[model samples]
Target chain A: MTCTAKKCGIHFQPPSIILIYEDQNQEKTRKRIMPIRNFSKFSDCSRAAEQLKNNPRHKAYLESVSLRQLQKLYSLLKGHLKGQSLAQSLEQVQREEAIDPEEDMNKLDDKELAKRKSIMDELFEKNRKKKDDPDFVYNVEVVFPQDEQVESCGWDAESDEGF
Target chain B: MAAAGGDARAELDVDVDVDAGPGQEKYDAEENVKIICLGDSAVGKSKLMERFLLDGYRPQQLSTFALTLYKHAASVDGKRVLVDFWDTAGQERFQSMHPSYYHKAHACIMVFDVQRKVTYKNLSNWYKELREFRPEIPCIVVANKIDADMKMTQKSFNFARKFNLPFYFVSAADGTNVVKLFSDAIKLAVAYKQNSGDFMDEVMRELENFDLQQKGEDFSDKEESCPEEKPPST
Candidate 1:
């Protein structure tokens, strides 16, 4: 019952997520058309992706597909509904996922902050080495490079104003 | 690849097109005409669509999106036209539909339960929202559940007359006027898409003109009048 997902794409007209997969048991390549209902340009891509992946009908086939990939597909569909071109949607997704260390996330709105946090969570999950990984090590240590001087912050400076 | 072909046709803005070759006349639709159904919850919106598209009436409730899409293939004057009938899927209970539901829509079928006077009164609000997004498309006011009271059909409804839109008294349970209502809607949608001076259509036409010029095909000669199909009497 092993299924290998080969490709995933979006259908804009009726708004469906099309998945091409190989069913090893049947030895056949099949396409699964999951109709995206109730989705609008303002829909949250991550929530939509989670729903599609957890759907009883599609859950089995989508088990091999990553949630991040599904979210990207939904994001592309959302962009198209908002009258954006394919290239524009891809660039937008890339920009959202790319984190800037200098950016102050505390200034972001709740929804924007949640989006950034989810992006960080996905990135951390991807880079994490699990116990089952070939490169897994019981104990690993690395030396810190302190070549650059640290900048002092106002909060870290002791002052008579602090209680 | 099939999905890509559908998307390409959507871009071309050719909603109804005749298939190639003589005598090979099974019309295959190249583009889709989106028709949205708006009404209050429990007003038989889904039932009417179910009755019209009797076969393959698989209604997927993607509650997250708050809409259900009913896909039906119909032929208008020998040209195959794929129609997507959008149902509210109870989104109306929240007092509004997502603006995307009206985005690029060709026509609208606003329904109300004949048994409920409140449903009838709410037509104005639904029509207002619909016009805010789509100002020029053809909209039909439907009085559904006519089977409950046939006398309702005899009673005049001023909403449709006031708006100058076509009206239909349909019964999803008995299938009265169901087929005619849907078929006529499809025709109106196709007509709107062909005649309306939408901005997207204008851009698509310019693109098509460039391709036609390179291929040496006369685009002007392809303009054919819409067939005047008589609406079957209910």
Candidate 2:
């Protein structure tokens, strides 16, 4: 359908009529269903792309990705540490020192911390192969500008321009 | 124009006074019931809602360019219920819906064009998508475009029956069972809300038991704390 704008009477075609199932005489029905093209074209794709790119969900998804990575790292580190609290662990180390002064608790703690860090690094390295996997689908949905918010984006309301 | 109206309502933030006349108090309060429409493209999901809301069908008019909201006040079970029908233009080509679209949805209407077997085949996909968000919400299956020659067969009825959902064969063109379908949808939504309140009570009882168990308290203590679930005298 042609936009009602007097000066810019550009024609915009709606998405093609999709008929997955129909009667046996499909050719006649197809001809009847198709809309006639009047005007040549209108360029709106670049602007639509820009709008899609700058959607808040895009930014939120990016932020969520990093946050999720950090969370996974935190969990892995916790697992490696055997659920020990710093204070309780320090107390245990002091008690161990009392039993045997020659064995350095600080050295043991540092060694343990390094071991956990290495384990986390190795896990990250192992999963890095799946990073580029085509099957790995991200849980993200495209968020359009709200109807109220879309008004400020130069979208002509009546004709549904810049869709 | 719809966007402007929606924006104006958003800005007001107060209950819209829909009562224009004296006896309109029967339809007073703004109890919002959100109903989402889902289906394959060209299945008349938009047309069905448009017909229901406007009481007229515009064949050439594509009512949904974006998420369109239709607000109608219905006197459901003696209560004024402002039902918000959200028409998500079935195809997710340019923009996929944010999770917020299903947020607080009270009911769903899954439409499929009876003429098109593919649309009928995609019913489960739509139902699954709806359940992912609003699991407990009541869903009604609608076989739209029944006016078309190649209508849905007995198998369609069985499909809806399998899910134990209310199903209706509707025609947006001739307005066959359209009004009753929407009215029934509202009634079902009201009933769902009522049942959900009771469902919450059941949840609270379970939560209280869990809390008591966590605290190492006796089961008898629930009788003292959860007075709401107290047995009645026979």
Candidate 3:
């Protein structure tokens, strides 16, 4: 399968579900193939897919690699359940498009670029002054903490050299 | 044996379709088992999973940063089992894994490169992380990249012995012990599911919570933010 990226055009095998089973009476193992349904058909991908395809920013970053991964994950999730729940879970991880700093470069018009530059300059000026203000403090941490039920484990010890 | 069957019956109160015909029905043995792979970057953990699942298909290393779930079916002792191989990004950044990734995992395969002494040294840290969340789940220690010139056979054996976890010397590139490792994992998972009384309950609870999260009804503040931002080092 060719990647969805128009520029990349890399040929890659799309992920699919293949079930290998054994006949109870027979000794040889057999296989059954299952079609991987399109991700867009699922209810959850509707909004995310639209955003992924229509937005040039997203398309640029999503790339063929990410698109393939997304499809593979979606197929695995959808294969297990008939409900729309898997779609919802996927939408959770579908991140918003980043605000590109070079967005103005795409427009060939000079006036538009100048206008964007002015806005950017104003925001940059505000950012610089805000950091120097004595009243402003970056207090994202909590003073008091309670013990929470969280589990983390590791091996007993480490060896730099193989024994 | 009857008691074991009875226990299994109670635990499997899943809403599996009952009306599907005999051959058409998804067999009880055909249940989905989630198996997680943990190892240092480039220990061939992903390759091992890909080789086992695709069975002779070698995929180009995409070097995924986040967790990627690969689904495949295996016939173990006349039972068809759907295995979900969760290939984690790497072990150096254990902080990336959400606690839920370990929830209800039927089995684990912790891998290390035979040539890289550093990867083998980090195995204990991986074990500790896994045991913290899943204290009782069966884990296997695999010495991967056996095709490499540097062989640590005895050391790998000793490490496996220390944890009492089954060990396999595998070469994912050449397809050595890859099949055995996966089949053994599936068997261990099936046995673990049969024996663990609350295993299914935990899985069900996690599944429900997953559905709730999908619906935006999850009120828990502890949800992982910025999940999988750091990709595994190539």
Candidate 4:
């Protein structure tokens, strides 16, 4: 996807899950042909077992990492994601004229978009003051899920890492 | 043992759903699942949740006053999974008071910082808390902050073995392993939620040992000792 900003243009390669194809009675089909970009993300029996196999430090390495460590890693990534998003959004504004969020976000230059998002986020954070927890800090966006409506929302990609 | 089936019967008094087909209805899958994050304050709980919950993160102030909820939708391997994650505060005393907002979660995620030993030590208390409210939940353990120092990574591995919880070492700051942790937790949650049976006994057993409820009752020691108590069964 290509997004154009007033002064800065940016290109986007969506992480995944952009399309949905379903036939009436039969179950919806997943397009497996689509490449799974983040291989390291899926840590199940296979992934965990692989950790034991892949590295020489496996024994010693496994010793230190804990759930809290994962939690902190996630928080840090959220920051990374925010930066990526602003970049993507600024690109979006430049590319489309739809006036929808996709367009509105795309309209701003990267710096301008980042500035707006940062200002609002700063205002909320300062007012909310989540600094007390030092070892771990998370900024969560909570939205109520409506069960009845979800199934109908075509191409649901809510979990997209860059979402 | 059939008793395993019976005890499971007691533990499970959830409103039973009669089958859509002869016996097939019971095997019916749910469209939704609950995933909870538990950890200490300043350990990056809220920030991690925001990364996964929202499309991206905002470099703003973070204070987890109340439980924040986020939902995600995706397909794991093949099955469509909707993950409902709760980002909770990590303050010690607050940890106890909060999270009681719900019961019997499908999955639990515990996060700790690698550099700090205190966060590592508290995993015991956090694990105990998991057992209390949602005993049968599948847990994923994470070691955060690998970027700042490698020494902490050493500490992180040590912490993982103590709990035997599935461990992931990632740099949320650099965008490393962040997605993997989210994906894995959901997959495991779905796997465990679906196989509530295959692992049901194991989960109940874990709960028995780690149950904070039992520990809580013992600590309160408020039960009255009656000399002439009448048997209700009589």
Candidate 5:
């Protein structure tokens, strides 16, 4: 499929399409589903319940938060809570509270929420590197201008051409 | 231009001139042109960047974890220039604080809100600080936010007369003389990098000395408690 510019005469190349098959058709092996004990229940559900008593069901919440955040939340109630900025402590407490089982059943805003996944990914990477600043920074997204980006505008070959 | 018009906004995320360069081209060969904008809070540095980058320069809600960089590739005299831009905040809190992002900038733009002449007066401190950090880098002194009240339309070349930096007065809100200033800046950056230009450096040098008194710096034997009242710029 071709991607047309929303309004202008320009057209952009569509991203490459990937093909997937339900069965490993004559190739790769079949994957099996295995369950580890619901370890998340102890940390996410229980702690969230203990903190706020209200957690709306979220299909993506458990999958979204960083592992460190989960561990921190779990540990917040583990011993005498570790040293944390008031903001950090409150954020952890809220995440636990947000994961409670008997909360409301509203839907989630997926697009806005995906922003956190990247933040979580950055945090996990920073923790692994053991850096001084573990927060996700915008520099992580200093993207190289893509070919599609080049198609946008500037340097008219005619009137402004000494190029 | 899509900028001065409508319906073209959503459609164009970028504006590239492929036919101009036309083919598998090498990355711009010219040395990168780094432009840094520093000024007091809300003096419109970011707005200027936005006006130059995107037509709608919204007020930044949060500090960029670091400075912002935008790349504009252009070819002049068969040389390609990739302009790397840095836009900074002018809050006093950030004044002495090291810019984690200001390492090797090639040129600097010290902006002031034209409406607030105090901002205009203090352009030197910003210039001094940055020059102390990168002496050889060329600079452009810009008076911004010209769209607001201008008690009178007096042509105050006061900012320009004082310094050697190329001085420009622009209203980013209305897009008055913005592109010309930007293109001129890039041209100056190019000339400086190649050591082929005189006007830019010459202008900036005069600009530096012109506003010394206005900046509350005493150039006299004893620090002058009050500056000699020079008439406004014409």
Candidate 6:
């Protein structure tokens, strides 16, 4: 029996993650309410999402659900718990996931740096084309446009020591 | 419980469908009152809630949100009131509660541990914060854990008298004045909601309308939109 996850939502009052799914075998849509337990504003969203996804009761139904989606839901819940509006939470999540090229990563603390790295990793995974993808290309090469002058970094500068 | 009888004058329209089957006896609440609890951490705010709710309680913790919502179906002056008792799930560590915690709140239960003098002193700060958000709503000052030292109740607590607010000496451990305090709170909340024509309600209503508009486009769209991209079918 195959199940396709359709939608996911959070109920702030009772603080439960509501999932709507379509069961291929029965050809019916059903809802699953997963109550979030022992979660606090300071709780880790990723860890909580992983726990929920791997729970024995939800494991079967949430097979099609992505860990990132679960994490996103948890993040929203966290924001709401911190007394932030839904829009505020969404903006925060967007800000976290987005990497600013102008921002220096060297100044970030260990925990913050790790978070940024994880965001970069997730973004990379999303954009990567797997072998099974229809549009997957092998060894595709493109010529670099030399019209614009590129700023040279110290590493890119010609090394004084010959290799 | 003496104060409970005096406020019974506020009559609410009763549901005529009392004979509507065993399982279908749904009490349609006249008002949804949000009563928030504020106090220092480990002051037994959650314990007081638990004591009040007793067997009819199903603790709904949204620790991620840093609060536990205890829903109670209360009958005040023949009117069914759905009381949402919001307990700070150790949010006191943040020094100040989130502004959203006080949003649309009809009443507040400010508690402090009797044994801890610091907790008692911190009441002024909590009261100040609460008044900043909800100035018109009824605020109750509770001296909890009286079971530890019953003698403490004899000493005059001027904090409640200073603010001219109702005071209760409650013990979550042995359930002393727990029922009275909660019931009185519900009554006060219901009364406040009915009489309140405050500007805050107007602001909340507008905010709620804005929320409704956003709910359709932003909230639902995000919820329904699948994150994983499915392969295109030929």
Fraction of native contacts (fnat) of each candidate: 0.00, 0.00, 0.00, 0.00, 0.00, 0.00
Q: How much is A104 displaced in model 4, in angstroms?
A: 44
Which 10 residues in a row give candidate 4 chain A its minimum summed lDDT? A1-10
lDDT of 4 by residue, A82-147 (tens): 554554544543342121222232235555544344433332343332334454344222222322
Model 2 gets an lDDT of 0.48
User: Sorted on TM-score, highest at the top, how do the candidates line up?
Assistant: 6, 1, 3, 4, 2, 5
**Where is model 5 chain B poorest over a 10-residue stretch in terms of lDDT?**
B19-28
Q: Compute each candidate's TM-score over C-alphas.
A: 0.45, 0.41, 0.43, 0.42, 0.39, 0.46
The digit string of per-residue lDDT tens for model 5 on B157-208 reads: 3443344567665655555556666777777667766773333233433444
State the TM-score of candidate 1 restricted to chain B: 0.72
Clashes of each: 3, 0, 7, 56, 23, 5
Off-target runs (Cα >4 Å) in candidate 4 are A1-163, B1-29, B53-65, B90-93, B97-102, B198-234
Residue-level lDDT of model 2, residues B1-234, one tens digit each, is 112222433422334332221212221123656677887555667666766666332222224334565667689768777676767643333223434455556788888766555556566667766665556778998876555442232332445656789877776655567777888889887777666643322443465577788988676443435433221211
Instruction: Quote the lDDT for A56 in model 3.
Output: 62
- Summarize candidate 1's per-residue lDDT along A22-132 as a digit string, tens digits: 999998999989999999988988899999999989999999888878899999999999999999999999987786644544346656756665665454355444445
Q: Tens digits of per-residue lDDT for model 4 on B95-212? A: 4524333343577778876545455556666777566455566788876655545444333243344456777665555434666778778888778766775345455445545565
lDDT of 6 by residue, A3-89 (tens): 899998888879999989998999999998999999999999989998999999989988987777788889999999999999999
Worst 10 contiguous positions by lDDT, candidate 3 chain B? B19-28
Ranked by lDDT, the better of candidates 3 and 6 is 6
Superposed by TM-score, candidate 4 places the C-alpha of residue B70 at a distance from the truth, in angstroms, of 0.7
Off by over 4 Å in 6: A1-163, B1-30, B206-234
